[model samples]
Target: MSRLYGDPIEVWTREGRPVQFVWRDRLHAVRRVVDHWVVSREWWKTSDSDPGERRFWRVEADPGSRIGTYELRFDTAGEGWLLMRAWD
Candidate 1:
């Protein structure tokens, strides 16, 4: 597995579930979501830190040629998306 830290991503969602995402200058279409969860924290440290709930999804995707399982997260405090890691 390869970890992609702080990788910005563009996600497409339907009914609050991620359907696709763009990462590493490539677009990956989600085939099936293996799991989904959430994590939340309070704002106490730095103002720059993203506070509130974050939604995460573990999905299998196809980047046209190869298939990969990826971990994606959405920051609720800022409504930003990130591609966390990819399973080899």
Candidate 2:
């Protein structure tokens, strides 16, 4: 399948609770609580620094899908979201 500009990473939830992560219209990986963490830091020094918290997830997609394997970061400011990092 062709990758869309904004490749969708579906955050799956059950009973209104987050359960796992899906990538590119496929089952990518499950979200383990131990694999998730929270970080709070001051970005005031940077031009876009804001007071907020960030949630990080370690996701594993298909066995050999480079683009499929990625880390997603969710921030509180602007309620923004990002694909913080990825690897093959």
Each model's lDDT: 0.87, 0.54
The pairs that clash in candidate 1 are none
Segments of candidate 1 deviating more than 4 angstroms: 43-51
Provide TM-scores for the models: 0.85, 0.48
- After superposing all C-alphas onto the true structure, candidate 1 shows an RMSD in angstroms of 3.1
Tell me the lDDT of model 2 at 84.
Answer: 60
Q: What is the lDDT of residue 28 in candidate 1?
A: 94
- Tens-digit lDDT track of model 1 for 33-87: 9999988766673256555788899999999989999999998877899888888
On residues 1-88, what C-alpha lDDT tens digit does candidate 2 reach at each position?
Answer: 3222334455654663345555445555443333568787566632455667777765555523333445666666645455565555
Clashes of 1: 0
- C-alpha lDDT of residue 20 in model 2: 58
